[model samples]
Target: MTTAPAPPTLPRTTGAPVPVVPSRGAGPTRLRALDGLRLLAALMVAAYHYGGRDGEIGDAWGSSPAYQFPTASGFFAYGCLGVQIFFVISGFVICMSGWGRPLRAFFASRVSRLFPAYWAAVILVTVVFALPWVAYEAVSPTDALTNLTMLQMPLGVDRVLGVCWTLWAEMRFYALFALCVVLPGATRGRVALFCAGWTLAAVVAEAADNSVLDIVLMPEYAPFFIGGIGFYLIHRYGSRDTAGWAIVVVSWLLGQHYAVSRLWHPADLPDAFSYRPSLGIVAVITLGYLMIAAIALGKLRWANWRWLTVAGALTYPFYLIHEHLGWVAVHLLHQDLGLPAAATFPLVLVAMLALAWCLYRFVERPLTPRLKRAIMR
Candidate 1:
């Protein structure tokens, strides 16, 4: 899943009591709690991919007596929901950052924040895993070129890395949100209109059974993003707005429907596992909503430790490279060389974190400003 860069803090407002709705110039305040939450979500995804059933390690170990860990059964099973958490967080952060910005500024900010780290991860994964692994073929020159644009799937090319699919969803969300930025006035009203229009389009696409429209509209995932927008509205403006509350309620109901459908979809269920849609799925959806709710309520404001923010910064790069690289490490050490899972898992995590930090420090931090300057010029 994709993670956004930390949002720049909005300047503090003074005089009179804080308004019910943020003024156009009102900036977003730093929320430390959300940073901690982001790190937890990233780790959850990593744990899910590494230890859950159908995971690389799980498939390799396969009911062996030596492979059992307490965490392997319960929470980790639901870790895939971390991607949903990311979508909600993305919506909240994007709304916070782009609230009063011009369309060109919003676009420039997104490209600079996303592209530098994304390009680094794409290249690193291609070199480290894609080329060396016998199981996966090296990316073709055309695919490599397409991947660099980060629009490979939309452009009718395959993703060079499996996890990059989330980036496409993020790109779509950004495109949809840009419409509000370009509107003439009342940012919140414009956003509300966009959400209402998009949700209507999603309903129409579903009714028509149009796969192309469904893909373009991304009706399936719209709820999470809309839910994020709802949380932002509630945060910036009080819960008094009837229209905002209605949007939140409708988005949530739709999101739940989409979640249930995916959980029960034939393609998603494993043949050996007689999976039923159950409380586990509900819990995942509920937990994601609760996280955003907490942010809206200021419950997580105290979570802002410097170290937590540092960890949050690592999330994007760690998420980018973790799955395939971890799988490769497990294959070589745990399966081929017979290293114990206990040792191998930690080793792989440490290596992934080290690589992530290197990418962040060397590529993301250094290149982002230059790229932003170049783009904004």
Candidate 2:
């Protein structure tokens, strides 16, 4: 009848771990795995340019037996795919960063994030690498001015650094995303619709052979970006939406088509290796899907390491500066100084990482906050 004595009341522990909740309209609090992924992608690109087809170091080493490391050589062949990974990551990160922010704040944040580090790389590469090592004539005053805007290609001006061509696509994506932000409601459904329309427009433009549309749609790369956005929608709203999956599937198909028509068609491949755009397309698609799957499965949710984020922060500067400078270093150390390719390659990589760290610490970190304040004000 006493109903087993009253259960003792337990005291609440104030020190219990608090769950980190995502802010309204923001992405998951952190994606630490993406940080490591960014570093890997950047390194892949560097290796590709250094040792892959028509690579600077590969060309300089001149069939030196020491330079023929199978892993490095084999990996370089697919290094260009790293840029595709970057575009997908950009789509996701940009959405995460801009979510719930006003147009002004988003624009300010983007400009702060991009311009300072970009400008530093441009100036440093122009003055140190291009002027002294590569083509002195190429580093004209107008080139410097054009490069500063990060719109050199669209403006019909040559890029200051060869690697900068990707920035144009990135900028275009930002412009298109900005358009979506300004639209009425600006809901996830509307964003998805916009991405689908953009993909369709890209396809139609390519089919019609419209030059203007080619510029506007950027048909070759839009699908990858669209796929990224599709993944974001799926992550945010869950997989119940069949439309999201459909969009991702359509984007993948169109992306492969574009890759075949645009990239592989014009590429000059080695005789032993026949042109196979499908390989690159499949690789990119696989990586993108894997990233989404990892997120959905909560596999990478625990990747909240601080060092990974630091590496991710260094990726942009490393990417911006590594290619040209690494080439220059190879020319100086391997060719001129008669150093072994084995030694010179690793040395150059280490030097590039050191320089990137400096740029991130001195230029990007310092300027970003100040620029954000100035622009947002």
How far out, in Å, is residue 295 in model 1? 0.8
Alpha-carbon RMSD, each predicted model:
6.4, 8.8
Alpha-carbon runs more than 4 Å astray in model 2: 1-28, 55-59, 62-71, 130-138, 182-185, 265-277
Clash list (residue pairs), candidate 1: none
> Model 2 Cα displacement at 130 (Å)?
5.8
Per-prediction TM-score: 0.85, 0.84
Q: What digit string (tens of lDDT, one per residue) describes model 1 on residues 108-218?
A: 777877788788877876787455443545677778878999889777786666777888898888887776544353366787887788889988888898988878788
lDDT of 1 at 133: 47
Model 2 clash pairs? Answer: none
What tens-digit string does per-residue lDDT give for candidate 2 at 72-109? 66556567777877776676566555555567767776
Q: Local error of candidate 1 at 61, Å?
A: 5.4
